[model samples]
Target: MVIQKKVGFISVLFIISMHSWCQQQINLVDKFQNQKIKAVNRSITLYGDQRDAIELNAENSSGIGIIEDLEFEKGIIEIELLGENNPGKSFIGIAFNIQNNDTYEAVYFRPFNFVAEEQIRKEHMVQYIYHPEFTWRKLRSERTGIFEKGIRIPPDPEDWFKVSIHIKENNIEVYVNDLSEPSLIVDRLSSTKSKKIGVWSGYGSSGRFKNLIIK
Candidate 1:
């Protein structure tokens, strides 16, 4: 009986240790100025009153602030994003399974479309794209509703909102503001592989991101 109890305790300890090892968190606010982040075509600035967030500005084209030394193939990626209500601008989201500056899969949001009166515009609230091949333009023209969809509950475009992305194999699920239902779900256009992840901002857009947790 004593031997069995000792073995059971050891097994429990091993399970807890393995769980901790599998979970990883990136300290975005504390490590903003460090070498952990590599910017690509992005002008990064510290934002928020507490200065706990980082802003990405892209003038002419899309930009990404890639997190260095971390490669993720699947699991959960959660972050808080803030974008302006400026129509035709303000695109903010996350890019993962990245291969390079021009190759990766991304799910972005057009905050201005969140509460648009036009049904067509509202349906464009959230989008997914595999860059360099399946650009937003190509997807919108070719696939249309297959890649983008409207949010069930709209968030203020000018304020912060929590975004949770779940990636499992070829399936991707996105939840906004802790909603019970996902805002969007789409099969990844690219093959599953381990690569870097980044905070992405679209053309002529400026956005703030914080509380980035990867699990």
Candidate 2:
């Protein structure tokens, strides 16, 4: 009886240790593989307890981070974003072909309240635009257009949302929350090739991301 009890305890301990190690491995892979672009100062630390955490500032343009620089011609990219303090005005989403520190094409998801004045009058919805020339003025309509239309993954303010994007030739498809069909698709937009991927956060809002897989 004593021998059996000891063996059972050892087995349980081994399983727990294995599970913890696997989780650490996944986190490490996401950290080392992606190119981090912070709009604010950031830090990654591991304590003696063998646990790790990444910290970032929520203000300024310090909340942006990029995973991969991809080609705009053809391919698919997906990301899982965990939002913190998403109040109604917070914004978190992906940007492509970031030419400079200030410009790129972004597909963003924010609450209806955060919609810009021009966007508010036009349509109360999420946005996807080609921000050419690095200014909001250069925003050109793409797949979804000015009207707000797409799946709304309920904002938990403390939870995460899975966003997936598919770009093939001149067609673009966006999906939120593992829906069967894409929520937004833009047919063609001048046929320009691009290849860059990153994440961004606004002045007061903050977001964290993981499980970024590309194919």
Candidate 3:
């Protein structure tokens, strides 16, 4: 009887430990300052007069706004993103495990492709890539359909949508809005070193981000 009681006590402690280890940390978007991010070929600005979010506008090439104060390894990242329906001009999403401005793994969305009628366009809605090596062009030409997928139920390309990315070890799962199922799942193609996380925008893209939550 005593042994059983001790085992039960251990189980309770284990649950408590796990819960504490996975506590969620919410970032106050309005409190972000321009100086807190390192912008690369992007215009960083506060969005809305309320300043409740940050915006990134890319120039002629892909750009990123890396949060200089934050570092992430593996956890759940949630953020609200807004973009236009401009074809090939509204690519936006999150970048993680960023080694630098030119190196990182990212999962970005082509907003215009959200509800595309063409099968080929729809399949390019969400993309996963590791820079300086595995780019979207190479992935499409070599491992087509493996790293990108069409959203089962597309969201409005010009509206605000929530994205949740789950990173665990070498695997990443992307969830759009409150969907019970992941929109895309892919294995990490680069080193799993802990690094900075940031907002990403492709050429000619403008993105607004807010309400970042890390767990």
The candidates, ranked best first by lDDT, are 1, 3, 2
* Sliding window of 10 residues with minimal summed lDDT for model 3: 25-34
Q: Over the stretch 1-215, how does candidate 3's per-residue lDDT look in tens digits?
A: 99999999999999999987776554435335536678888988888887887888769988988876676888889988998888878999999888878888999999899879999998888889999799999999999899999888889998889999999888899999878899899998987764789889988888999888888
Model 2 per-residue lDDT at 96: 68
How good is model 2 by TM-score?
0.59
On TM-score, the candidate that comes out on top is 1
Tell me how far the alpha carbon of residue 191 in candidate 1 is from the true structure, in angstroms, after superposition: 0.7
Q: TM-scores of all models?
A: 0.90, 0.59, 0.87
Give one digit per residue, the lDDT tens place, for model 2 in 1-215. 99999999999999998766543112423453353433323332222233332323366543445443233435566777655543454566666665555556666666433323464422433456554432222333432243235353443445666777776777678887767676666653335444556666655665555565555
Q: List residue ranges in candidate 2 displaced over 4 A.
A: 1-56, 61-63, 68-73, 111-125, 132-147, 150-157, 187-194
Assess the local accuracy of residue 192 in candidate 1 as a C-alpha lDDT between 0 and 100. 66
Each prediction's whole-model lDDT (CA)? 0.89, 0.53, 0.86
The sequence of per-residue lDDT tens digits that candidate 1 reaches over residues 1-215 is: 99999999999999999988887877786667786788888878888788889988768888899998787888999999999889989999999988889898999999999879999998999999999899999999999898999999989988899999999887999999969999999998988664789999999988899988888
Ranked by lDDT, the better of candidates 1 and 2 is 1
Residue 83 C-alpha lDDT in model 2:
57
> Global lDDT for candidate 1?
0.89
Q: How close is candidate 1 to the true structure, as a TM-score?
A: 0.90
